[model samples]
Target: MVNTISHIHCQNCSMAPLCLPKNLSEGDMARLDTIIQRHKPLHKKDLLVTADAPLRYLYAVRSGSLKSYTLDDHGVEQIIDFHLPGDLVGFDALATGRHRSFTQALETTMLCEIPLNSLDDLSAEMPVLRRELMSMMSSELYTSKQLLGSLNNRAADARLAHFLLGLSQRFADRGLSGKSFRLSMTRADIGNYIGLSVETISRILSRLQHENVLLVENKLVEILAMDRLERLAG
Candidate 1:
């Protein structure tokens, strides 16, 4: 954990609507800045919140990404959710003091910590805050439902296709790209979530690359033949 967060990167990301930096604009966003606190920058594989850890603040992703997952009895990691820039990560701890899943940074990550009690007070004072909170919750529910639908109805290829598409959408939402993006999650993590093996993931990726559908280099995925990739995903 590096103390003194990188503020310049914060400026670059804040201007984009994807991250919660937009929370600074007007209404409650203004009030939010008053109580919000930035934590130490986390490098790859750093744990933000551990399962069963005490919940103190509402977390917002300033930059980078986070993945939350839990271990089964056999010690296999089951990914719960992946949080992108401007996304909230620790909502499940709102009512409970203990976290149900552990959240870890996927890259060099920055975070905004809002004391839950302070947010509660602000929500009481600002109707905009309350409404926005409700909307965020609703949106998350819809996303979960959609992911569940994919898991139930889509095949392995389609599921992976949809997963990549979903990532593109989230990236685009945060002012990133549908055609190019960085992959911080490992093939094993992706395989576990999509019910595939790591070797299978590698094979599929290579197959796609060989077909000129995309290019994968050092965790960067470039959509060379974007439509072709989408077709395979179908």
Candidate 2:
């Protein structure tokens, strides 16, 4: 459930540099902030957007994480992406005006909801805003392509290693420790996203731990050898 919360101005948000507000003039930033709405934190498993839902707001994750997935004909979930803080959600709906996948919080999450109509109007007057939005969308597309390539060509162990390395870079980009972080998605979810079985996921994790490449304590993973992990990922 979403509850209206006090606003946090774009100028004051730490994510400003990494999110939509990046490189915007003060006045433009202020205008952009007007359309962004804050909400009470979402608990684990709370759906942010459902497939085929009308496009309303594009969400900017402020904290925690979320997963976007789609169901096949058999209703099996095909996990697409895991959204961390500083990531944008809902771009998938822009072309059709309906969401293509279901996005749900993997843990407690906070978001800034940008009303689509207002953003469309505001972007007309702000070239910087428009450019930033395009850049984000392009980045999203590139990441998707990279994921597809990895799934097609990488081995199971390489896929898992690459996934962990990707997480490390994302966390580090958000000013967190690159060597250690919590995994919000369960092993099953990870396996689904990377095209592996739950048992395979467990086996690879245990193998990494045994090889002294990582220290795994339930959801907590500490990369003990980043260089070795990179080689494994390659």
Candidate 3:
């Protein structure tokens, strides 16, 4: 049987609007609840969906973060995207009924797993839910397109600068220290996502630190000059 929850209030619940179908009424939410499954708590670095695993559930983060990646023909891991609290892990996988990439938790996480087969039924029955689902899919595509543009047109420094700001905004959404947050993604992951080498990523970060754009303390980044960081991002 699928696990179900009642309501989602961003201020109270761990998951926010990212996972929840926005503007869903009590009746709509109740219908979705019937097919929702609550997954087990995951620890940091715990693998959720490995490449080629049976794609069964579309997971929404109830708490914490997840990172999805895939290995190329050369066995080089390319970090695809980062999914923090309220982010959805896989929905496209349902099309093929197979996972094409790996998804692992960056921090201890709890997820709400919705059986893929049931999603269509819910969407068809609820107009608001259907629109919200389409919105999420559009947002994901937009993020991917943005990433491609950044890789093609932006310099490595600008890429890293923009990436940091994006992360800051994500952190702020979860009530975390947005500007002075710790990096959960590794340098290698960062390099892969930004289309740069680990050395290059390090160099750019070091340059930013020296430029007084931020104060670095291990994995933590404290922004010292917001305007300077914005200038670098551009």
Q: What is the lDDT of residue 81 in candidate 3?
A: 93
Which stretch of 10 consecutive residues in model 3 shows the poorest summed lDDT?
A: 1-10
Q: Give per-model TM-scores.
A: 0.88, 0.96, 0.89
Clashing pairs in 3: none
Report the error of model 3 at residue 138, Å.
0.5
lDDT of 3 by residue, 29-75 (tens): 66777788668788999999999898878898887778999998999
Computed on alpha carbons, the lDDT of every model, listed in order, comes to 0.77, 0.92, 0.80
What lDDT would candidate 3 get against the real structure? 0.80
Which is the leading candidate under TM-score? 2
- Which candidate leads the pack in lDDT? 2
Question: Please, what are the lDDT tens digits per residue for candidate 2 over residues 1-234?
Answer: 432357467889888888999899898899898889896789999999999999999999988899999998999999999999889999999999999999999999999999999999999988888999999999999998988877887899999998999999999999999999999999999999999999999999999999999999999999999999999888
- Residue 10's lDDT in candidate 1: 36
Candidate 1, 1-234: lDDT as tens digits:
444453434344463365444444554455567777778788999999998898888788877888999988898788978888778877787668778899988899888887888888987887767776776777778988888887886667777777888888888876668889988898888887777788878887888789887789968998887677678666
Better of 1 and 2 by lDDT: 2
Off by over 4 Å in 2: 1-4
